[model samples]
Structures are given as C-alpha cells and as structure tokens.
Target: MIASSARLARAAGGSRNWLLGVLRGSSYGTASEASFQVESYKLHKLEQGPSTSVTLSRDDGLKMYRQMQTVRRMETMAGNLYKSKIIRGFCHLYSGQEAVCVGMENAMTPDDSVITAYRAHGWTFMRGVSVQGVLSELTGRVSGCAKGKGGSMHMYGHNFYGGNGIVGAQVPLGAGIAFASKYRGEEAICVTLYGDGAANQGQLYETFNMAKLWNLPCIFVCENNGYGMGTSVDRASASTAYYTRGDYVPGLWIDGMDVLAMREGTRFAKDYALKNGPILIEAVTYRYSGHSMSDPGTSYRPRSEIQEVREKRDPITNFRERLLSSGLATEEELKKIDTEVRKEVETAAEKAKTDQELPLEELYNNIYVDPPQGMKIRGCDPTIMASTR
Candidate 1:
C-alpha cells in the first residue's frame, strides 16, 4: 500500500509540472549575441548597397520577435472585432507585412519622422503607440491616441506623422518634413511609405523631382505587397520594378519578408539619404488578409498562392526559425514570449472594446492648437457652429 501511494504521488507531481509548463513555458538557457548573414539586396542606381552580415543580440532578437507577434496578434484581433461590427468603417490588417515596420523602426531613432498610407496600424504601434491605443483608435474610443478622432487611417505618434487617407498624398508631406529637418539644421530624416497601388500617381513623380532637386533627406518606401487592393501590381503598373522607377533617386529592393534584411537595408538607406538626397526602397512584402476588411484578398490571387507564401516566406515564422537556428533563443523562451504578447494584446483588446467614446462637445476642441476664447467652428451644416472653448 505504501508503494502504491508513492507511485500515485509521483504521478500527481508530474501532472502539476506539466500544467506549469503549459502556463509559464520552460526556458532552455540564456541566449547570447551572434552575427548571421542575411540575403543580398537588389540595388537600383547605386554602385553598392548594405552589407549582408547582421548582428543579433538576444535582447534585440527577443524584442523583434515579440513585436512582430504582438502586431500579428493585434491585427488578428482587429479583424475579429471588425467582423463583429465593433470596429466601424475601413479597417486594414497588416498581418504578413510585420517585418517592414518592425525592421525599419528598429533601424530608426525617435527623432526620425515617418509617414505612410492608410495601412498604418502596425507602423503606428512601432512608432511607440500601445496596442490599446491602436485598438481604441479603431474602436473610436475616447482613450485613443487621437482622442478617437483619427480612427484607423490617421493615428500618429511623436515625430511620426499620422497616416494619410489619400493615396500618394503623404509623399510630398514627408518631403516637407524632411525639408523641415534640414531647415532646422537637425540630423533627422523622414521615412515616407506608400503602397504599390499609389506608385502610378502623377503627384509622386512631381514630389520625387522636387525632392531630388532639393536634396531632401527623405527615404521614400514603396511597400509592394504584390497587389494593389484586389488588382495585381502587374495589371496596374506599367513598370513592376518600383525600386528603379525613381530614375534619378537611388533605390533598394529589399526582401520585406526578412526583418533583419529590412533593418540592414533601411540602415543603409538612412545613411545614404542623409548624405545624398531622396532614395527609394521597395519592400517586396505580401499581405495575408484582404486590402481592407472588405477585400477577400484571394479573389484575384489563388488561395494556394497565399498559403504557399505563409508557409514558406512568412516574416514572423522565418525570423523565429532564424533565432532558434542561430541559438539566439530557444523554443521554450519564444513560446513564453508569445504567451506574454498574446495576453497583452487580449487585455488591450478588451479595454478597447469597453472604452467610452469622446463627448460630442469635443468635436471641434482640437481643431486648432490654441483656439481663442469663444471660438466657433463650422459644423456639418454651414449654418450650424460648434463652440471650441
């Protein structure tokens, strides 16, 4: 009977350990910094480009992994919320394109400016906005970064210009920000991003010409995600080589699926732009979800193609494997990080869902940085005026 009791006790102990493993995740050991070679970059109008070698410390690797995971999870949650009708209006999901923002932000400083098109949620988060802030903005909650006014497309952070809703409109504005940095005698550079869809805009060419003429320290990025909305890039663009489209401006075609590559290429681009003038970078990424919530994303492209890219070229998964293979992180450690990120996103999402909307009186409050006492702003009806006091 004593032996039977001993066996039962051991079994119970084993079960408890298993449960603990499930919750806390096991750690193998502390990972150290290491250098690994990344893919070579495709250059445009340049003699050379960024080095392929990249150094990865444990801290940076873990941070990048956690960030990419957080964005992915947050986007997934946003999609769910949108589907449930909790988030109204246009909602763009940045699932497969996590590496672009994460990688570029890692290479940039807080003083550097960024502006992008309507697909700005991930960029907003990378620019230092919290998950709750992004979700709340999507939910139109009072606690959002924009006081729930900007919604999905117009969220902003410090030195990080808000996403512009108009296609290709932000490029010229980004140049202006770069011009401001130069004017102020600051070392800051502006990173302006737009999608492949906006590549054909005439305003872009005009902006490019002016930026080159002024030698503006701006990095114009084209996030070529294969398709422009439901239409394939090939069908829409006369020249699919977006990086080389900027004839006078130097460009780099980066593997947007590789975060490390993105970082290195961006680092090079920033330095080159600071020294020379405006440059272009085509981040050849893929979007897993539809253009907005409205697009199925698979109608034009085959579902098999999307699945293939997810399985083969997914940025998060590829980076995870790179970390493990480089001995930068163990599976257990990554799992633990994943658990934390998932919980953080889930918690933020819950708060976003429950947060209150701004009071109607605040509609015209922020129209001006400083409004005169008893300032009145026109409402939807020209005859109606709203008090800004």
Candidate 2:
C-alpha cells in the first residue's frame, strides 16, 4: 500500500511538469526567448497608445488645419473632375494621406525642395501651388504650372521638382538636387518621397550609399501605405521596416495619421539632415483611393478595412479632434475654415473646366531651349510649319 501511494504521487508530479512544459513551449526554455516575448508585448502596447502630444501655438495649429483641409478638398475635387471626364490621363488623388504632406510641409523652409511620385497633388498644394493651378493642370489648361503640357502626374511649382511617374526613379534625381544644394553651400534640404513598393528597387540602395558617402542633405521618406498598387507590403517587401533602409543614415518611424507626430518627426529629421547629413523617415499612412481611378480598391483589401482607417485614423479628422481638445481651435473656427476651403475649391474647379487649352503650335515649343536649325520633324507638313512661322 505504501509503495502504491508513492508511485501514484510520482506519476501526478510528472504529469504536472509535462503540462507546464507544454504551456511554456520554448518561451521558458531559453532566456533570449523570454526576453523577446516581453519586448514584443511592450511594443504592441506602445503601438496602441502612441505619444502624440504637440505644443504648437494656436496660429500654427490653425494653419496646419487649413493646409490639411485644402489637400482633402483639392483631392475630392480632382476625383469629381475625373468622374466627369474633365481631368484626363491617370489621376491619382492624395485624399487620405494629407497629413504626411501637410505636416511635413509645415516643418520645411521655403528654400527646401520637395519631390514625390505620381500621387503628388497634395505635396504640390502644400508646396505653394494654388488650387486653381492644380485644377488647371489636371484639366490641361494654359494656366497650369506646366503650361498645359504635363498633366496631373507632372505638375511643378517653385522649389518643387516634379510628380515623377517612374517608380523608384526619383531617388537619384532628388539626390542630385541635394548635391546641388550642398555644392552651392545653401541652407536647404531635399525631401524625397516614395511608396513602399518603390522601396524594393536596386537604385534606392545605390542612392542611399551615395547620399551617405557624400553626406548629402537629403531626407529620404518612405510613405508606407501598406500596399504597392494591389500587392500588400508584406508580399512586396521582405523588410517592411523602410526607415531602416538607410542603414548608415539615421532613421525615424512615426504614426503618419497624426499631424503633430509627423510634423515633429519631420522637423527632427530635417534638422538632423541639416546638421549631420542624410536621414530616412518612414510614415506609416494609408491610401483610401484605388491605386488609380481605374481600380475598384477591393481585390487585395476589403471595404471595411478602408472604412476603418478613414473613420478612426484620418489625419484631417484626427487633427481637428486634437486641436479642439487642446483648445487650439473651436468648432466655429473650424467650420469657418471649412466654408472658405469649399468656396476656394469650387471656384478653382469652375475655372479649370472653362480654361483655354494650349494651341497645337505650342506643343513642340518647350521641348528644347532652342530648336535645331535643320531638323526634319516627323508628321509636320512643311506647309503648316511655314504657315505658322
């Protein structure tokens, strides 16, 4: 009886040990595994509640609010124009990602240069292009910043380079701009914006190496909106942490939905680049529109997913809430700004729709600084050229 009781007790103890081992798995087998689990839990908590407070003055807050509103309204108007067939040829609206551009613009100096991909209406607006000019560009009118030549994907303004179409192509051009700024010894920085899809290109790393080697004053920003066209970042990129792409260059990751967070983060990056050469910043934002107007935006992502980001993580709405909570703005003040922006956008759209287009003769005029003396231009009836001349 004594032997039987001792054997039973031993069996029960072994069973308990086996259960504990199953519950713990590899977590308790090694110190490193335990430490990793704890670190991951802490990071998850940080993501849930990011530190997003800012100390902007009332005026600055109001200005940022207005800037964000302008971007939203402008993109909305562009969408309408595209539907009505007023704007033609590849219209990409920057509706949901306004905060990344507006907040970064607020932190930049007038002399600083900015460049981005085809989804560029927001940055152009933030870079001092008027609503009328943007709309006119979309409509291909004579009053466009590109003089009715380059359409939506090629608009430009003072100190703004371009709305490049080629993916990952703008990095080297932006580096050249930075090189020029450094060569001239100007207190200016170049901000190069690209999508997560473009992050996988070979040239991006080459640009990074060159930028770091020469210590160019360039801030390479990756707007990781989670999707590269239809492919999710996870599918397209092996490493989704784009801020660390610079490797040698210091990196920053910010909640792109928070205007203040983006503003502060961009300011820090700009200052760092100015003082210590180059830096990389990754803004984790989302795009509400399809990759282009042709897409329905439903193949890879669901409507509910898009709606959640719009409702809860919209940069414009988020900014308004923060401003009101901090006493930086009142509902009445916000409403007044909204009313003015609506009027401005409406007027610009009307002008864009009615504006005159560039004449055919002007098409080949700006291709070169001076036309070649004896160039046989194809499709040019000699009679027509002579008549025009």
Candidate 3:
C-alpha cells in the first residue's frame, strides 16, 4: 500500500530517511546528499541564485509535491467558497504560485520570518496554520486564526507577519521585523514579498533605502506574475526588472514555477541577508486566476496565453512529472498523496461550514497587543463596528 510505503519511508532506515521521517508531520528537511540535482536556475541581472548541482532527495521531493497539491486544493476550495457566497471581499488566490512558497519555506529554519501581500493562504498554511484554520478564517468562523477577524488580508503567526492589504506596505513592515530580529541579536531573516503591481510603490523604495542603511536581514521578494491586476508587467512599470530596484542590495532572479529553483534561490538569499545585509529576489511566477475574486482574469490577456503556460509550466504538474521521471515516487504513491490531500481539503471545508460565525461585538477584542493573535472575521459581513478588546 502507498500508505504503508509512506509509513516505511518515515519509520524505516532511521537517519537515512531523515526527510521522509520529518514528512510524517508538518515539518520537512533536505538530505545532506542530494538524491537529485537542479540542472539550471534563473537569476537577476547576474546569476547569483544557486546554479550548482543542488541535492533534492526523494523524501524532500515528495514533501514538496504534497505541499504544492495541498495549496492548490485549498485555493480551489477557497474559490468555490467565494462563488457560493461564503468567503467574500478581496479574495486573492495563490493557486499558481505554490512552488515559490513551498520552495522558500523548505529552505529556511523555523526562526526565519515572512510577510507577504494579500495573496497569503499558501504562506499561512506553510507557516503552520492548518487547512481547518485557514478555511475557518475565510468562512468567518470563530475558530479561525486571527478569530475570524483578519479575513483574507490579515493572517498572522509567530514568525509570519501578515496578509497585508496595502500593495507595498508590507515591505517596510518586513524591514521593521528584520530590524527587530537584528536588535534582539536573533539570526532570523525577514522575507517581505509584493507583486509586480506593487513593485513600483514609493514606500518600497524607502524601505529598501532604510534596510540597506541598517543592513537589516531582509529578503525583498517580488512575485512577478507578469501582471499587476489586469495590466501586463511591461505596461505597468517603466522597467520590469524588479530585482534591480534595490540598487544597493544584491539581487537574484529565478524561475518561480520550479520549486527546486525556489529552494536554491531562497537558501542563497537567506544566507546572503544574514551575512551581507539585505538582498532582493524577483521570482518569475504566474497566477492562474484573476487578481481577485471580482476580476475574470481574462480581460487583459488572451485565454490561450494563460492556457499555454498551464500546458507548459504549471508548477504542480512540472514538479509531479519530475518526481515520476526521476523515480523519486511511483505513480500509485503520487495518486495516494493526491487522494490524501483532497480528503484533507474536503474535510476541512465541511468542518469550516459547521464553525460558528463570530458575533458583531467580537471585534472589540485585540485592538492592540493586549492578547496575542486576535480573532478574524471573513469579509462576507456587510457591516462592522469597532470596539476595544
């Protein structure tokens, strides 16, 4: 049975099965010796990202496959919830950007911090929030992380800052978080991410200036999905090279669709930030859906264009093929993983439906830091009144 193999992969072979062992739970790690290697990589103006033969063990490969599928399934469920009038207001799906999150999260230690723009369900799950927690939050359930208050743009956690609503606002907050880590003498670095749309925001430049001056351990990430809302990257910005925006900070550009490349890019950037101040990375990713729930996502770009990318570079399919071809996992093993992930998502959705929606007065709590991790409400509510909690 595939389940038996998964169990064996985790239980048998001890240290040799390090990554597989870790895969039994929420965490994962890469082997010291790569079971496979990344043949190529993407970089900024220069090739600063990992171009060497980096090891990617079978266990690690399976872990990434599961992670990407989980995110995709979660986002798919979110979209359905939005259509059914459950999740509302400013819902941005990260269905196509799984590799970036999975790769980047796997490359770092638990101490590292991350902050991103509104598209954050994947990152929230990667940072340890459960499918139930994420779905409950989006559904405005009392059990939701942020207690059903933060909704789509305000999820937060231990080392994860938030699903910031402002376009480029999280960039400065990320720098501040890195500054705090540095002030406390912690070795953690902060990864702040924005989309190609927010790449040109004036505050982002200001954050870059301050981060460079203070040598803050911040990794500024530009998830350049080639479109800012409905506008193409070239038309939206004078220069589409987001990595070079941080003139003083060193930069790397990489293929965001490839999870392995993402892992190498983040690993290299994390080390560069800890030792050499801040760094910049523009991950060339794509989003299969509209900018938000309201946008059809087909107005600006041709359907064929998006279809071509899906056919050629869909991150999940690409990684899945690599795993199969490389003999890292069997077809049945992968099917089991997909089945398991689907069941998890469906179970989470059903449970989310039963969760009690937060009351109007629940907003009074968590005005400030009186209590850590306040409640959140799904944006479906038609009205809200403020109170001190």
Instruction: Put down candidate 3 lDDT per residue, 146-170, tens digits, no spaces.
Output: 8888898889777988899988999
lDDT tens digits by residue: candidate 1, 1-389: 11100010112112211100011112323445556556668899999999886777778989999999999999999999999999999899999999999999999999999999999999999999999999999999987889889999999999889888999999999999999998998888999999999999998999999999999999999999998889999899889999999999998998888898899999999999999999999999999999999998878999998987887778898778667655567889999999999999999999999989987767765566545656666432222334333
lDDT of model number 2: 0.77
Look at candidate 2 and tell me the lDDT of residue 71: 87
Model 2 Cα displacement at 99 (Å)?
0.6
Candidate 2 on 1-389: residue-level lDDT in tens?
11100010112112211101011112211111100000000111112322333455667778889999998998999999999999889998888898899889888988999988999999988888899989999999998889878888898999899899999999999999999999999999999999998999999999999998999999899998888999999988778878777777777777676676787777777877888788888888899999999887899999999987876677888667555544455688899999999999999999899999987866665554444566545455555445445
Better of 1 and 3 by lDDT: 1
- Write down the TM-score for model 1: 0.89
Please estimate how well model 3 matches the true structure, expressed as its whole-model Cα lDDT.
0.81
Indicate the residue-level lDDT of 304 in model 1: 94
In candidate 3 the C-alpha lDDT for residue 9 amounts to 22
Using TM-score, rank the candidates from best to worst.
1, 3, 2
lDDT scores of the candidates, listed in order:
0.85, 0.77, 0.81
